[model samples]
Target: MKKIFTINCGSTSTKVAYFEDDKMMCKSSLTITAEQLKEMPKTLDQLEFRTNQVEDFLKENNLDPKDFDIVVSRAGTIPSVPYDGAYEVNELMIASVTYAPEAQHASTLSCLIADKLVKGLDVPVIIYDPTCVDSADEIAKITGIPEITNMPVAHLLNTKMAGITYAESMGKDYKDLNLIIVQLGGGITLGFHDHGRIADWVYDDEGPMSPQRAGAIPTRYLADYCYKSNKTLQEMRMYLCGQSGLVAYFGTQDVRDVEKLIDEGDEKAGLILKAMAYGVAKSIGQLCVVRGGNVDQIILTGGVAYSERITEWIKEKVSFIAPVTVIPGEREMEALAAGGLRVLNNEEQVHPYIYYPKGYSSIEDIINNPNELA
Candidate 1:
């Protein structure tokens, strides 16, 4: 049996699972409190602390890291990669994630911790369905600005797995269906899957507002507000990503508490929740057009998908397009473990790490000096 150790790091928790072949043996998650996060200067500073927690969990479970045949981690924000699948962890991948331009999340420390745990062992470290999996068509990359191009960033692992699983239930292959997937969690991303490839997806910052993200806003107003507010870049980043959304409106990120207010007859809470669902449904409609209106299934998967109120709202708005399948919760650990098993069993090939420089390559130079400009 192939032994696999999988790690998925979220903003507030680190989830570790042990898998023997396709069966999960054990799983544990360590949550870092807001007070503890306040003490750290940067996300990377928690590397040692989080690694220690992993070690403690392994010890408590009477497990040894060296006994595992392979280590797999949830993918983090890094330089864009072209394909999706298992990628062998290497120094280049680590360096890119460590210095990524976006806000630092706990996932950036995943490979670092995995590499540390498997040091001196022959076991390979792999990352599956990282957030930076870009598969947009050339036409999809065009933007109004000549310098700025749209990039593909979404909850790819769980979203893609949800499509595959749903396709199997219908006795069809994922590659033969046109699917629209919406992932509602701390942030929201809606993806359009054309055949097997993700043709287009709503970037995290450009989709519906979620429990903790601002999502899309008026760009012109944002520019004017930035000039008037005088907030630092870091503060603005937090406002747009971490401190906006429901937290900005209600002073809390917990959806259940928000639901409680609605249950207690809070009119404003009810309206806001309905608005969020409306935004999600609108995004789904737009992506359906992107798929040429041949949508076979619409899948909703994420933490917020558990909310019957939200799902029902979304379904009522978009059920005319196709069947809506609610696969609640982020099934990241299972997806990672399944990816590891596929690679180990030779069902999917493990992709080698290739460093692609930032920015577009020259259109004129196709044959020679391809690496001249990034």
Candidate 2:
């Protein structure tokens, strides 16, 4: 029996799961409160603290790190990710992730945590469907501005798995089907799979507004807000991505609460819920044209997909394009384990980690001395 350990590092929490072969043995989530997070101001600083949390969980569950045959990790915005599939974690991956093009995030430390867990053991650590798994075609990458290119920064771990799951359910190969896979969570993303590759996409920031993200807003209005909001750049950033969506109106990201409010006859809540579904359906329609309305299925998967009102609203709008299938909840842990199993069974080709020439090798210098960059 092959033992697999998967780690998904979040903002202030670590989610881990153990699988013996294809069955999940146990799973856990280790969350850190705001006070505890204050101790590690830098993301990398939490590496040791979070790694210890995973160790404790394993120990408490009577699972040893040494006994695991392989370790799988969740990754985010690392320098050019190899998009074909699962990649073996390596030094180049670590170095590039530390350089982090945008803001440094906790999931960037996933490889670090995975490495620590399998320190002395001869185990392979692989990351599956990391953020920024760019597969958009040349035509899809174009923007009106020649200087800028549209890239696919998506919730690929869940979207890809959702497509595969549907393909298998229909007794068809993923490579032969044309699909529009929508990931509805705190942020929403739509990926258009042409054959096996993701040929087009409606990125979270450009697509539907979600529980946390504002998604697409008027460009002129947003540009005006940059000047008139009188808010710091960080605050403005939060407004665009973090503080917008449901949280902006209701101060909560949970759709269950919104639905409860609807149940209580809250008219405003019902309106916002319908608007969310409208935006999702509009994005689905946009992607449908990408393939000339030849889509086989439109699949919805993620936290928000659990909402019957939203999914049904989306289905109501886009059911003409293709049959809509709702597969609720995040399956990141299962996706990671499945990817690892594919690698172990030689069912998929494993790619080597590639580094960005313009990336940093280490954050060690800056971590110890904040003034170094200055």
Total clashing pairs for each candidate: 0, 0
How much is 142 displaced in model 1, in angstroms? 1.5
Worst 10 residues of 1 by lDDT: 365-374
Task: Rate residue 238 of model 2 by lDDT.
Answer: 51
lDDT by residue for model 1 (219-331), tens: 89889987898778666776788778999999888899899999999999999988989999988988888857899999999899999999999999999999999999887
Best by lDDT: 1
Candidate 2 lDDT over 1-374, as tens digits, reads: 88899999876589999998889989988998757877775667787899889989988999978788889899755755547578878766654555443544677778889988887778888888777777777788888999887766777788888888888999999889999999998888888888878888887789778888899988899888788888876557656776689988898888999999999999999999899899999999999998799999999999899888899999999999999999999899999998888888889977887555233444553233332111
The C-alpha TM-scores of every prediction are 0.93, 0.90
Q: Give RMSD (Å) of candidate 1 vs. truth.
A: 4.7
lDDT of 1 at 367: 27
